[model samples]
Target: MRLIKPVEITPAKLISSNVPETDYPAWLVSATYALGDRVLLDHTIYEALAAVAAGVKPGEEVVTPEAPAKWQNRGMDNRWRMFDDKVESLTTNPGTIEVRIRPGAVINSMALFNLQGKSVTITMIDPVEGEVYRKTLTLVDAGVTNWYDWFFEPIGKRTDVVVLDMPPYGSADIVLIIDAGAELAAIGHTVIGAVKRIGTALYGTSVGINDYSRKSTDEFGNTIVVQRSFSNRAEFDVTLDTSEVTRVRRLLAELRATPVVWIGEESYEATILFGFYKDFQIVFSGPTVSDCSITVEGVI
Candidate 1:
């Protein structure tokens, strides 16, 4: 089988720095600035680890959501999944941000295994104004399953999709969990065969030439050609068997040359299904060595 690449996210680059606090209410200004920076950082780290887990490059962009297309129609009855719900609250405590689901809205039978670790809590408080906000907590380790619960069913059977959202400028803490059963496959087991990043640009400038004839027109037409650039970063993981290594390498080369659409500026979460296999082989390379690693445990 070909090697599968994981999804990835880039580090958040600082967009703004030091500013005077006099522009707005002390609490509002502090909260906005702190939360904005935290959001960007958390997003960047999530993408990076997610991509590494999938065995893809570190800079690949992926949208963040609960599941893939196949799981959208499962019959869970729209229960309130803990991590799937978006939470918002205003308080003064920066210790922990918590939310309670109106118990029973979620079907316990449908729960699955927890895939990640302890949530990373980001607390933004305006000391002057006494306003505070929190967001989806970050996990310390990769592949920590302790933080979530999972549920599953047999193959060819349908599963329900949990609809979760986070309120703007609000705090959210999510735990990763899964539902497993006979015939139910862990969604992360499906391997990514290959992944690539691509971009294009204009090549050279045009030159002007004079025509000899009286009916001559200026010969200044531009010679435009397509120029391409590729990310130096790439990654791969071993699954299925060791012989699959060569095939995975070839797949990586192919992905490097594939064309990709430019989405401009956006944030996305991507999930990969690994289909019942545990042991995996991964490799990565790029202009800058990535701070990437794998987490096999259930808790971060």
Candidate 2:
């Protein structure tokens, strides 16, 4: 029942990057905009909502009372899609994509979802001690069960990566690098935060994906299928000290609608999730121990 309470990495925190933030033209305060016109501002795309809007700065939303509703936010720009919290929207680049961050606050864990790269390199530098941590991970899964799969099947790449061993240093500058050799490098969503251990994930834990594809049958018994993305889901029980019951209740209360990296057991990859929970309950049957059951739903 361990989880990551991620800290929001504002756009300003992304101090440097190899990728450019030029998906659309920069918003001009003097330029005139017609209805449905789009411009980029602060790495976000905003669409003009008026027939003709001039000297109106584009922002995250239509400022009410403060300014006229001239622009409506569409979504993140192409280069900023990975930090948008939506796993289906990918941030892509050729050969490699690199970003540097100074979180200021201490962060010990980082989770990568929907990755499309051959390898990843993470480097951390302390202000006084210099290079503190460096690790490179190959993205392919090497475990093969059968001879046919080993010879005939293409190499399987694990899209999800969880790094739970970062040194807890607030001043360390962390650099994330994704390499795809000669092909494209892409990432869907990334989570960097500190971990919170709730309890152990007992047996009978379940993991699956919720499909959103459309299926219809014609009168003649023919089937039509419209493929769609899916969201990963999981349910598990936890065992924690009875004294932490109040703390767990409060933590869940604060993270109700917020999305965080949920890591049930560090050794179990399927137990990790980055999403919200629909419902949870706590039960106490003894004086020294308590139990918790939580159901989590992930964002695509």
Candidate 3:
């Protein structure tokens, strides 16, 4: 039996979000953020509590955007603000940044700055609904040089979300055939087999042309590109008993009417072909032996 498996997970240009259901890049600490900046973390968007200083780090117990002292979240007026003036001047005592917005200023966004020397995970609490967004950041060097920007969404809007991309390649795993109609059995089905070979490349599409010699012909019909669906080929080999050979042939015949094929745990919407062993021969040995090889053509 032949099967395909991933030898190594190559680091391709493709990136996946570790965050659940969102593609927002992980937050960074070396970066600088100002008022109204937005970041997606731990399935939530955190606005900068205050305009982070040029060299301040986030997640610091000593330098935090807390309520009443450094940060404020007011539910009665739907306003969340942070007041940390000492952070900008690197001062230990409480001070005020003159640019701080007052109570009547229309709150537009939030920002975060990473002063931590290494990567850190932090959670942002939603001022209104109390929802928590968490995410991790890469090491931000020892100083403050990195920065990110985020505009505020509407009052009730969620953070930016994105879907993951498909894998660039397919594995070479063996295909398993199961009896979909059988009850629990002490042993199992009378026949068992696996696919031996399949296409090495990932699923993809192709294009076609009606004329081959139309290369650079000036006419409109000569320079058109036709799109076509992609196809993948597979081969299966199995040994069976004479009685099981008939059942296997019957199963192959039934596949013609089915629209999907199962290759291990993954299912592909495909079409099957059995031209290779439709008329397989059974040898009469001690236990009537039959060998069958089946070919399949699938549309990906």
Candidate 4:
């Protein structure tokens, strides 16, 4: 398995985007926002619960005049949802969506999760060279069990994709494009990270989700379900060289509870998890090989 510790994205690194914030406006310290007015601050949306006077920040506690607390944090801004590190809220736009980035550091791995795009294109262009790298990927997945299923059932699309072995260049213009075929293009999380080869992916790896939706049965034997958000979970084991035990342990300690990408297999999208692991244990049983298991919990 490969580990990818994602870099924190900033406005300077994210050079440009085709999508714009149409609903929410940026918060201004000098502007007096009335009650019920929503504004974007630090990639999050906040609404004024009471009268917000000048110099009162959205996330800060209100003083004297604006005393009873002024702002109510609603959620992440739609334009910046993909960078929020949360999988439930998505950055959506009509038609094709594209983002231009200058990582400002070396990165060789990129992944997209919970996307609604049919096809995706990623490219890198250098200052001197016209195009350094380019690749296009599709989201369709084959699940037909037999001829009957293939002829009767419709094709299904996966929500995630991983691109590895990307050419690393700090000054290159990295562009991400997603085409939804005139439909809405939505992406929940997109990350660019430097790949760290840890071990080889093995079998017995499991992938699924933790359903948080409340469900109950009524007194009359009626089933009632309150739909709520859910999160993905994965448990995977990897086999690695026993010599790298110290480095692996240190890396795991550093990345504990921090959101990072774990790829069990590059081609298997189901094994690609972008979340935090709760606990991990490594066992050195043989002479030159070791085994490690990680249980990851997704961010909702």
Candidate 5:
């Protein structure tokens, strides 16, 4: 069957320290009636757990079923009456139903449903008290789309410890329908620690500066060094005149540095030169030359 929605689960609140009874409910013990009849309880404990995990809040209503019933043949008056009666009976008398919350914990939401073609029951045994809350539901041939939904009460102030059991059926399947909210709640707890750590780190580093660095090493294990220095005031124009000027130009181009020439105020411009290496002579002959420094950067 396809799941239409996700389950919700929330933290359960502690109600009492006393444990429940030990006996399993009669409905839970004998899932099938005489003549091979099936009794189905629409919801399961696992589904309730899932709802709680998904964040179903207290006082929220969720529907469950008592057993699976046929949905077709609703036009028959007798079938309709049977269906209505069964729904009312199950809703009114959830025999010996009790919710026990574990101490210091939260109570998640509950799940209820009907099982098709199977007799089912629920028995909760509080290990501490050895008391059991037993419940039984019979399967009926109700029309399709007319199944009953059971609403669980709010996870009030008094609930501690929960134990549930279901009897085996020879020919019917027992399915657990859960609440979307409770499922999420259960998963959230599993990763809560990691989420908290990441949140802390993000908050702590919000105002810090981030530094970036890059380095290259040669085959001989020697590291290429590049440096940049800024100079203010002195300026000179240098033109290469030697035969090795081309090689020097190539080397300069490979150095990965920008060359800047400062003219009169508001007339400054920069150019990138490259492809020079070995035996290059640059002649400096500029009227605005007195004392200037060359800044070099990048891997050599």
Candidate 6:
């Protein structure tokens, strides 16, 4: 199986020196502002120049009709910095991937994405504190597919590991994408087995009367009969236009314990069939068409 490139997200800290408070009240659109009254707007700091009826937004360098440009920007060159902590390509190497965690860093949430769109078992080991967090993520698609499949929100955990490796718990298969609308011509490996009858049926029907009764006599020694309810089962025959007896037999065997869903038709609980009986019969009809009649039963 082919392992694709991995992506990771890491938290970044913002550092600033001699930073002033930008938490002043926002400048209203049509409010009177006095000179030297500071206001914050759009992540910029602005100050009023003269007593006017509007127009003083923090950090704006424009002189609009609503407010004359009387704003002063008090921000450093690099006050906020975002980190490039996406770890990719390292996951393709299995256990060779390692990530460093800074000391005294707070981690409230942690999420890992497995874009393979398949079920995988993983064992995560924190080598520093020797703590193990084990959990199985469901079917995860790739980044472009099901990107946000696995996550540990509000983990409230801390780790001091200098390096961490993510290896497979056992064996994992790489998931591949396939188009449901693709025709047989586009799919070179597509095999058109047969145009057989495919439908759903239930082994039994839902019951409403179960020990349902009403008192007819006031005598304490009166005898009563319990009502029994039964479920309606679905039964149909699938006739294939193929002469492959062995293939028909194998198909019948797989349908015995497999759940089948059939919808759209107006029947009693149309698509609620659980499975079919293991016993099946196949009859030869002519030289090509064969009759493989099987009972698709209800679950309940």
- In model 4, the number of clashes is 1
TM-score of 6: 0.25
Poorest 10 consecutive residues by lDDT, candidate 1: 70-79
Candidate 2 Cα lDDT to native: 0.86
lDDT of 4 by residue, 1-300 (tens): 997888787888888888887658888878999889998888789999878789888777745764577888888777788888887788988998899888888888898889897899999999988798999988777698899888998889889888886888877878999899889999988899789987887899899989989989989999999998888888988888999887989999999779998888988877888899988999996879999888888787
lDDT of each: 0.23, 0.86, 0.28, 0.86, 0.23, 0.34
Q: Report how far off residue 248 is in candidate 5 (Å).
A: 83
RMSD of each: 25.4, 2.5, 26.8, 2.2, 34.3, 27.2
Model 4 misplaced regions, further than 4 Å: 28-31, 62-66, 142-147, 218-220
Give the runs in model 2 whose Cα sits over 4 Å from its true position. 34-36, 60-70
Taking all chains together, each candidate's TM-score versus the true structure is 0.15, 0.92, 0.22, 0.92, 0.15, 0.25
Question: In candidate 6, what are the lDDT values of residues 1-300, reduced to their tens digit?
Answer: 000111222233112212233447766878877878766664344666666466534454566798556655543111111012111111221112112332122222122221222222333334453434444433322223233433523222110011113332222211112211222101111010112223222243222211334436546877675544323244445455555667657655655554333221222223222233435567777687666544444332
Could you tell me how far off, in angstroms, the CA of residue 119 lies in candidate 1 after the best superposition? 21
**What digit string (tens of lDDT, one per residue) describes model 3 on residues 1-300?**
212211221123112211133323334656677676555433333456677554443333264345322222221100111112111111111111111111121111122211212222333233343423344433322233334222332222111111111112122111111111232101100111123222221333221212323234355666645554333445444455666655555555654533222231122212221112223223333366655554444322
Q: How many residue pairs clash in each candidate?
A: 72, 1, 20, 1, 93, 14
Sorted on TM-score, best first, the list reads 4, 2, 6, 3, 1, 5
Clashing residue pairs in candidate 4 are 1-199
Per-residue C-alpha lDDT of model 1 across residues 40-158, encoded as one tens digit per residue:
22122211121122222223334357622211111111112112211111111122223222111111111111222233222233324333444433333233344342233222222
Cα displacement (Å) at residue 107, model 2:
1.3
Clashes (candidate 1): 72
